[model samples]
Target: MQQIDIDNHHLNFQLELQYARARQRQRRRNIILIVFAIMSIFYVFIQPNQYGNKQNQIQYSQTNGTNGAINITETNSTLLQIQKHFEILEKLLISQFQGKWTDTQLTSNELAEANFYKTSYQNRFQIQLHLKLIEGQFLEDYYNQFSFYLNSSQLVLPLEDNNFVFENVRGSYRRSSVYENDQSSLEIFANLTMRLNNINMDSDTQDDIGIELDVRYTLDSETFSFNCNLNIINIDSKAIIYSTIVSVLGVIQFISCLKLMKDFINENRMASQFSLIIFVFLMIYDGYLGIVHFFLALQSEYFLTPAFLELVLFFFLELKLAKHIWQERFINLQDNLNLRRELYRFHLKFYLLAIVVVLLLYYLIYYNVFLIAMNLYLLPQIIHVAYKGQYVEFDKIFVFGLLSTRLFIPIYYRGCPYNILHAQVSYLTVTIIILLFAAQVVLYYYQCKIGPRFFLPKWLRPKSHEYFIEQPIDGECAICISQLTEMPTESQLDNKFIAKIISQNQNKLMETPCGHHFHSICLTKWMNVKLNCPTCRSVLPPLI
Candidate 1:
């Protein structure tokens, strides 16, 4: 009953050990699952804001008006009248330069003179026109000229009761007027005519001509104010191409945030999930900035905000994730003081400090500095650790991952002239992915391969024993196990029969490499081959 109880106890001990190991495995798996769930939740809840409905709000205020409606009326009508007159001047200049005939024919010298006049007029007119219209300066010189044209009936000025009108040489007309009451203001009427010029009239002839007039009146004074402008609307399609590229890259950046989370998982699941949450929030903020950019392209404000935010967030998350992964693999506070001492003595602090300095330099100056320093500092450590048989799997993976990253460097840094923003973001994303992948590979290898190799050197070698077996008179010597020997000790003689059998059977005696005697020869052989002192396989050297 006692024996059976002891056997059952031993069986239970083995089972308990197995259960503990299984539990540890389960715990690790759970940690991974928790991280994955967190990341998935972040993506689901935060990703939609990046791509859904966008809003644009525009607010404008006009000067020289009591009512908001009055402001719009005055501003739009004045701008339109000026635009019409500018168009007329431009057509007249083009016709005169090309010697196109209206009812009045011009002599060649007159045409040449008009051409010269047109060039000079356009040059000076554009400069003054920009100042007057854009700078909001309706100078007296400009207004008097419009008044002269209207007074001569070459151009008819509209009614001064807040109405504005423009008639083109093609007989098309645009009329706009505003009305105000004691309570509010309203647009009394607005009409515009657009005409298609006859191409067959003269292919080379310039036909469109008109006068631009700007008018203002003080309601209390009832005095008319006017300014003349030469309007030139030069529309180019190239600006649209640049805006479209920016918009497309913004969309791509939002999508890349989700991909970044996946890369985080491949790095270190637990810490990566935390980083993913932060990045998701950053993506939402960036998306908001993108929306602002789209709506307010004309303002050019808030342009740098998103880029600044992105750069900050990217750097922060990258460092945090790297630290997390590295800590898991290399840092162990609970390790023996002596072991830590040895590692420190090996200049681990120097390496770590170098890493920190490089990272800081990257943030302060240039990213390539970090890359160069990391390569220079880390490659030697990897080789050293690998040669020590530490974290073999991790070392192999790290080597490969680093190689891949180096290969990707050019790709990351290649700035596509047409897609500058996209290229920069892509470079950062790729860099983060490579770093995370390398870190993970190192962690996994350390956990499995390197950790197991950490055993005491003494346990791996052999020890010596002192006992020796006597040989039987009629049987064999234990050393040769073939030649018979007569030597026998008193105890051996007392158990001579058993001793003789043991000796003849080649079973007992041992000898150390130093010529010391022992009872177990096989054990001595094992000790010698393992580099322990069979009598001492120490630096004292083997004894013959």
Candidate 2:
């Protein structure tokens, strides 16, 4: 009965140990699953907010005259409208000056009598016109003064000269010498120039000349030109702030990456170290571009052209770096040199393709399209990498954080016009990222709890049970396979074991170049004979 009880007790102990291990494994798995679920939910709910925020930003940019808001189609439409109005005004001016008047047109007598010019020198007309007849009121400032010289008659009549006058006009104008030599043309030009110039000379003079009729009958019939001058001061201010903030953040990220790389190097984690180097280079490049853009923005209101190009480069570099980091952190753990090389080449090709796409979009579609596409592409890649369990290193987490921060910039810029929409979206996306990071931290803590094993601290390994055995082998060492004739006493065994094997164990045990163990005497002889491990034939360490 006592023997049966002992056997049962042993069986129960084994079962308890097994149960504990199973429980530990289950707990670890459950924690991982929970963290993954949280992250998935966060991404699913937050992604819509990202898209909505971007869309709101686009709408705001368009409505508020921001650089990226207006689409190429809309901008082209505006340009066409201005061009059409300009063409109409050009036609009207030609008809009025040439005196080609139908019932719908004004005759040369009517035009001259309307004071379209200040004076007429022979055929040369010096028109100082306060003609309010211009159709497009948006072009009033440009058409405020006029000077017409007839090149056909070699006549020079300087009617009015101002900074914004005809002297600044670089383009060709029709010249007529007949007007200068002919009395009818001279009288007509003089009458037109005087009438146009007299209207705004004085209020009293305008009233005496019946200004309302002159303005209505003469000036009102003339066409007006349109010119658009977009003020970029506000955009410039915002861009400076944006670029500065991004650059500072980029620099901080780069520094953090460098520190992480140093840590990897210290741990002899070559793969992570290499991956971090790529990220560091990319971040430095981005920082440089940001600084350059900040300076450029100060000089020109529309610096986004060059800034967008930099952004394209940044996107490509960021993608390549991210892929390399992910691969280093999670995949291909066999130290597969070929796989690493292939991944590098693949990412290089991908970056090249991304660059081409960005350029094509900028040239063919719209400049702002590059920014949108970059964020869109990056967000997916980040989420995909995260979902794949690809981020083992903290550097990768930091990189993802920086990438996530980029989403906020467009949101802030969009807030200028669609404040409510951007605010809600920003709040949602931020909340999701925060929750996801928190879940990750919890998962990491649990992982550490489950297994505290680390790559370092060789001395901290559990001492082998064989080391405490009282009986020493009387025959040849199991590893050396040499004959032993003399047997030492227990005290001698203890002294030799402690002194020759343990204290001087570093020299007695040969560690191969690959870090596998071997008896030194046997390994040295084997290396001399074969230059490889006796057991595995892996390259042996060099003799001292």
Candidate 3:
């Protein structure tokens, strides 16, 4: 046998060794990103604006311990409380949407206050070229406030019937385990049928029908919001355009999710969970769309067709993911947990909150930075991938789907010449936004191919896991029992064939920390069943 030129072994696999355990750190980073994503999403969902960090306690009539029951008087009292809540909610809604015309007269005190505000602003803010930038900012607010105050008093929107006919009100009661007797919370919900008179504003007559109020209240916080959805009255082109755009985006998003789901159909445990969570997120979005369309239908008779059709489609559309999750959990049961029913319930709960958000923040339809923010959401993921120094199986479909979904609404309103709102957007701004999106996508693509840290200097990258394994030392292979000291002739050892084997087997050979060497494929097969070396029985680190 010809002695192998082990010293001169310049095979690609021999040049650098990548340990599987190091990949685990990359996976751990991925996990942290997932958790951060979840928590950020949840925070947005709850939107708990902690009011001055103050907690108010409310007393509820105690449930009888003997029977776990409530008193009739207590129930009636709760109804009275809900009625009072509705009255308060009605007042709050009137303040937000009730726009005042320039012709409207201000109260004597209000006029006096406006005059004082103007005089104070003029005295404080002399327009000099001085650099009090932060202080100068307040001048704009003051001027705008004075101007608005002079332009209006209250619009004085009255109720349709002037009575609290609360059609529905339900509440969930939870007592704090730590302070069960003293601190309890009541999350109350109410549905009321009501309409405000005279909603026309700025010479733009918008005939709105009755509004649907979904009030959320916490007795402990003494906080409540009308959180109502105002029905669109007349069938208009804008409504049609907006609905169509959203529906089309949903189709794109759903299709991409299905494509991603395809990657999860295998026996990979982590992949299954990630895919399921993504599917659940889609369900939540579907629920939000359902709310939006439902409101659209309520606002216009012409919109009823699109609205109902969407719902019908959604009914069937959910089946695809539902069936996938079901099969994964029951038919082809794997150890990776898939709580299908729980996830469905989770989506439902989020869907309910989404409806509340849509109602309360209908201004988001026209946008308030939220739409633009969506396009930049990938920044966090991009940063995470770079920090992890790994390519974690991202795909083009999902990336572009997210980009398209986020950009569609904004692009339609800003880019379309014949937009329903007839708003003129700067063509340059739209172009810049598109270019920015393109740049981000390109950077991400580059990262996926040549590691996430491609932008970072090469020396900073982790090289500890990598070792020059093809040292000029003679050794014997434990698994193949081949002469590690021999190098065959070009015809016998074919460079192309050697490279193919290395690629297929991750690495042609692996070096254990305890000075053991084996064929990479052979060691991998062993690690799947046990974590000890075949020859040394030394504890082997697990692969990522």
Candidate 4:
């Protein structure tokens, strides 16, 4: 009678083990299916921002004219529109001039007017400039005052200084170096003597004539020498470079977010949706920013307003992303309701304070404050992780990349005050992150084992039975009715385990605090989803 009972028990155990394995397989399939569905939905709904931007451009052009100029109404005069264009051109010229020139750089708001034209060969470039009057009101005739032209040729000019006398203007140009391509720099110094016929050349009467001007530029001296360190990169080439990098990052992060979404859905984790939403917003903003850069490169005046708006949006989104990330750490611990509530309450207060800061302060100050807050919030987590000395999570690596640069750069800049080293360090850190993220994307795509393994220290490598809870007595799992350590050969179950399942206890099973033993895979999945013991529905203790 005892042998018969034992045989029946073994048969039932075998059936239960098969069922548990089958359930895990089904769950995996369901997860994959859900992920696919979500991806499809995003594809359908979240069209790339560029497409809409293009459509808007087309509609705008059609509405305005074939020439793509804005139609001015009585309220919006042509002069007002012209003034707006001049303002944008002034900013661009000032920025480019200050960045490239070495001599007699434009003082703040000193560039009165600027325009550029490309020759038929496309290699020849001409830039026109007019300096702002020091005294007297800017008049409609201001456009006619002190016009100067800078010319560059694709043909490399001789590296010698020479004096040339044109019909109306006499000048000396020294071509020290020529810009060969987008990657190269151009160094040239030029001085010109302008015969200002429109201006009353008399020094005392210059203001009366509506012209305040210094007409002579010297090649040998700094008078009228607009410092020349011109590295002329085409806007299109710059746009391509920036757009390519941003596009690559956007694609990789989009994939990462999709993976995260899948995990959240599979585990039925709703608490982290706020973070996901912020992440999505950031991705959208990044896409729009890239589009803005491309349009700006094309010299589209229409996108200028949008570009500033995008910058402000980026600042806000970055702050929100940090906030959501901080909130998610605690809320993700589904078992700890009290802790989650406290964290949520804290986050609410922080958010209100942040809003006040955002409203009261400028974006630069807000950016610095956001960085400081992020570092402060992440410091405790970093310390905890270091103290625990456990496996380094994949998300932690991502967060580290995001926060580390922000944390150190601001501190360095604060101490040093606008040092060139700050810029170099920022660039170096960004380049490293880009390379690492690219590598991460490729490794993740290939399912490389080394991706996660290399990030963790040897001591932190998981041990056998690390996740398996030993129970006082053995029984079937309520989630998956599988017998534990009661078999003719425990090793026989090894082949049935899924890829994620670690058969750590010599093919033995896991147990919960409630005393029910289960297949390690079954209990782990159940605990991950609900944080409860399967049989008695008791909240499980938090794992390290």
Model 2 stretches with alpha carbons more than 4 Å out: 1-243, 259-344, 347-351, 364-373, 381-401, 408-544
Query: Candidate 3: minimum summed lDDT over ten consecutive residues — where?
Result: 126-135
How many Å off is the CA of 223 in candidate 1? 40
Query: Order of all candidates by TM-score, from best down to worst?
Result: 3, 4, 2, 1
Pitting candidate 1 against candidate 4, the one with the higher TM-score is: 4
What is the per-residue lDDT of model 2 for residues 417-440, given as tens digits with 9 covering 90 to 100?
Answer: 222111111233334444554554
Q: Tens-digit lDDT track for model 4 on 1-544? A: 9999999999899799979986896686567546644644454456354321323321111121112222334243533443333222222232221112222445422123222222121332233443322111221111112344433221011211121111223222322111111122222233342211222222211211111123444333444533222222233343344345434444444444444445444643332323333343343434345343434533322333334333433433343454455555554354556775776886576556545544443344323334334234333433333333222323532353332322333444333212221111123333444454455444432222222233457687554224464443455556545455443222232123222344444354665565556776666545433455666666564333
What ranges in model 3 sit over 4 Å off? 1-236, 266-286, 301-368, 392-394, 414-432, 458-464, 471-508, 512-544
Error of 2 at 139 (Å): 27
lDDT for 62 in candidate 4 is 11
What does candidate 3's lDDT look like per residue over 1-544, in tens digits? 2335554454434444334544675586567546644544444355443211124312221321222222333355554554343333223221112111121121111010101011112223111000000101211111011111110011111223332333223333332221113234343432333344344323233445333323333344565333333343233555666767666666666676556556545533223222333443344445555555554443333344344433433444443554465454343323324655655765587567656655644555444244454346456557756554433444666578744465665676656533434333334436656777777778877765555576877687555332125553457767667655543222222223333334554534567767787655555544433456678776655443
Of 2 and 4, the candidate ahead on TM-score is 4
By TM-score, how accurate is candidate 4? 0.37
TM-score of each: 0.25, 0.30, 0.39, 0.37
Write down the lDDT of every candidate, Cα atoms only. Answer: 0.33, 0.35, 0.42, 0.37
Candidate number that wins on TM-score, 1 or 2: 2
Query: Which 10-residue window in model 1 sums to the lowest lDDT?
Result: 139-148
